[model samples]
Target: MFGDTIAAISTAWGNSGIAIVRLSGPDAWAIAQRQVRLQTGAPLKPRFARNAVLLDEAGEVIDHILVLPFRAPHSYTGEDLVELHCHGGSLAAQRCLELLISGGARMALPGEYTRRAFENGRLDLSQAEAVGALIQARSNEALRAANRTLDGELTRAVGEIYEELTALGAEIEVGLDFPEEDVPYIADESLADRLEVVRQSLADLLERCSSGVILREGIRVAIVGRPNAGKSSLLNALLKESRAIVTAIPGTTRDVIEAVLTYRGIPLRLVDTAGITENYHDEVEAIGVERARAAMKEADVCVWVIDGSEPLHQEDVDRVHELADTPHLVVLNKADLPQQISEASLTALIPASTVISVSAAEGLRLDELKESLVGLVSGTGALDTGLNASSRQVEELRGAIASVGTGLKALGDGLDQALVSGCVGDARRSLSRILGGDRDEDLLHEIFGRFCIGK
Candidate 1:
């Protein structure tokens, strides 16, 4: 229904050297032609640009401009397109859009153009989503992953797996069709082999998903520990700003103070939560303590700050043990002060826990802290390992893989053909959902809604 022709301020809406009013669909060329004379003035050739004057329907001058055009099936959206590279002023872009809308073009909806591209088969769902990723990518790593997905790296991998499954399913079908041949489709010996290969591939992709997730969504690391252990001070040190209160009094931060700090170009959401304590009498402090516990549970990484100047309190010991099952660290704060705890002592308590001694008071060993935090965030360097990254996608793949295993097991047991086929079909449908094949309207809407406008 969007083919009536759409126009929008395609370029950034602001004062600049140039702003673009883009038109796409069958009306694109017609709109451009009417605004420019092909004969009297040397007009812009198709796919090229020329300086021209933009005139209203009444033949009144709007602005002098450069016009560019691309024929259908060649440009973005796989549709005829026109771009009026007019003056960069925001008002000018607005006026151009107004003129076009008056000319019978509706404003483009968010991601409408990219949606058209998907509809027209110019790009797949993954590539279309990558458009938004590329635009919002914060770090070089994130941009590379987004570009890989946009360039069809992810789609190609998915397609390969789907192809393999299709062939395997077909083989299963053949065995089912000709029971007289008595050929075992899923041999017990070969079943494990095929599954191992496929499972390993999925595991590898799932591994990359972790890095891809960090690259795409970034990681949330919550700084938690007893108050006056320099939790706020650590936040400030990492963010290189006095973003949180650092009074000597305990529980100064009675709420979550968050900062977005980049490490190795990867964005890490460092959350400074209220110190985990048991003695706070104030209701607000109690709430903060509760929040801190909640944040630690939700975080991808937790940094436990223990004051090096003070003896290890049981409260600290108790909280450390709480995160023993989670990704955590022992950060001995105030290292510049007289050491009240030894490294051997700390490590013996939190075995296998990497301890980093730092002085938030004097800003000592923060570099090591950041290094350790980044390591804990994305691992020492697993971003290189491809990760399937999307938890939704991962879950879907897992479901499909499980169904395949069930089908293979049934085949091995020479179960009824219908039962085997049913499992295979179920698995295929799961894969189809990932590829956006035969997706419901709601699913498509939800997926596309995650995309930004223009993409």
Candidate 2:
């Protein structure tokens, strides 16, 4: 769609079997032909890889490579595209990119290729965002969720709701245009019922917000408790490695030890914080305790680790009490030893929390702990829908839902048809923004700026 050409190293910059230097735009094919010297002396063919020698602007050899070309409208970016498959490493790819740029192709900006795809009608705005999501996905579930969006699942879902709102707006507009009739085009009850359905549909999409985000971004779990309570041991057991130092000494963990566990295709970022207690052995220990509390406050769930082998101390009671209003799981740790604490006492303190007995040192029932953590964050639906709306998309859906609610209220109160129609129009505009139809240049830049160059 653009008059100029753009180039970049499509592959990651590192030593590998091959590195791709890509070019796109009107002059892509011409630039490739000028820089590539086919070994077979054959004409450059579209969709065929030809052995070639790449040359710089001064007529110097840069690298021996394969020249692959794609014609306009069929290639990515919907422009003539060329890929120079050169030897892997920073040198060849870098040199090839330099030559292409010198040959008149400008350096592609971060996510420029995908941005061009959006501009050329190859993908919608949500699909463009999905390309970045798929690139940054950290788990299998995240990948699947991103894939669904790239495949237009999100656009389709929003499209249905958008259509319903548009139809409602048209119905309301009929009465507004025929003010002389002084009669409603549709029954107020029927209009209210249809608007309610639209509101419910928007709410349903909004409901997927938490699960989608948790799937894409993962859940943060902070493991905290009194020192010598096997907090480090629990982290180690979950990660199946000695990621944190474990000892019988209290306040041994003087900092937050963080690691990640991918449980059931969802990432659980586990933070093992220093023990929490009023009694500190040193200034460092006190600081550690402060950090421990901070981690618990920030985490999606606090896995409160309590030593079951020891009698209930005031510290244990205080820590458990703190979790009363927080989303947390109580682990009565050291279960392999003779128990001195009863689950009843802790449950009575925090009647709503889940109490699981586990022996971290012996790796007892860690699977159950993981399962519980997954269930706590996974919500009560199948994650297969792959509708992971970003915070921006979620906010838009909320706005649309609010607008629909306003329209419903206006209709119920027998307000002017014009006002109700305006509400429907507002809802449609909000939904349109989600698909990039009504987005501005700055918003598009902010969204695509997060992408890596050559994407």
Candidate 3:
């Protein structure tokens, strides 16, 4: 444990029921001893709370306070700790910290407290990272994922995979060392069977990474279409708010308007871009159109809004090819009005694309659209973010899976077990990386930087 005491107001700085000042270190309790005069009791005992009248160094009364102590190895940070429940006020907490500073404590750094917990081996790397994932989680899916990782769900899964790989490696090593023992060596099918099991697990895990990551980080969706094609209207419909301008005038929206909304418990960042059309009169509008194209390129998926209120134009047809390779949906807007374009005509242009007949103006079929969006994001083994997920795991499952394939192929080729052993060795390192076995220092610093001061 650190010898210097650290102090911070752990509660959020705002009007609340109460605010707490926390201290932990070897001298944590001693530093808090001098600042607040213990008006009603003897020295506070470890793990005990005492109702004491608080006073400044000048013996001036501060507040009626309760002090609790935790002894070394039993407390957070594995050191002596103290917590003072004080009145919830910014200035009051500041004064308390200042008083502590005058006595002995220094301000705690961002995530320093949690860093201490990590130093004390209270949590693994994944669980330590989970503290932040849990804080930033936006969906129930995300919450469940983080909780699972915090509770070691991903760890256990990875462990089972690793153990299988280890066993395979041991079998290969045995054959490598004792080829003359007349013992029956593992056959090609035997290796293939083990390799297939490992590959399936890895492929399944790889499939979920996309959806798992998106749930943890909100999915990016860009809406694109010709000018005045109800792109902004679609954003407003999805967000259920007048977040963007809608007008009869073409190109009214010359830039992107973004809003975050949850669809079926999954957070989505809907980017409503300026309508794409030829012959822009304004330079800014032209730039906005180019940027819209770029956004389409980068988004996880694109939503092409077709104005059900307008006639079919060549712009819609040509623009569809630009996103032909991109995952997209064909959204037909203005279902409330007399449809000028038939859905059949649009379906002829793109067969695989999902066509959602939606009225962004009246909010018709929006729920179905949301569900379609969910289905679009959720893939096979979509339980990536289920109650035991690890969104920030460091291991690369791809290489390990590939190595297993190579090993099996070598065995099939009748190559000696040395080559198989090498592949398995690489696989073991990859799995260990998931458990933060060989994590570098810079990643740790970068992670802790996101934490709020006072932890």
Top candidate when judged by TM-score against the true structure: 2
Tell how far residue 21 is off in model 3, in angstroms: 2.1
Write down the worst ten-residue block by lDDT for model 2: 379-388
Worst 10 residues of 1 by lDDT: 384-393
lDDT of 3 at 208: 59
Better of 2 and 3 by lDDT: 2
What is the C-alpha lDDT profile of model 2 across 1-455, one tens digit per residue? 57889999999989999999999999998888888888987788889999999987777888899988998788878888999999999998998888888889999999999999989988898889888878878888888888888888889889999999888888878777775568788778898899898898888777665566777778899999988899999999999999999888888899998999888778899999998888897899989999998999899989988999998787776777777887789999999999999878777876778999999989999999998998887667466664766878888999999998998888778787788888899999999999999959999999989899999
TM-score of 2: 0.92
Best by lDDT: 2
lDDT of each: 0.77, 0.87, 0.78
| lDDT at residue 167 of model 1 (Cα atoms) | 72
Query: Could you tell me every candidate's TM-score relative to the true structure?
Result: 0.91, 0.92, 0.91
Write down the RMSD of all candidates, one decimal each.
2.6, 2.3, 2.7
Model 1 RMSD in angstroms: 2.6
Q: Model 3: how far is 341 from its true place, Å?
A: 2.2
Task: Give the distance in Å from residue 307's predicted Cα in candidate 1 to where it truly belongs.
Answer: 0.9
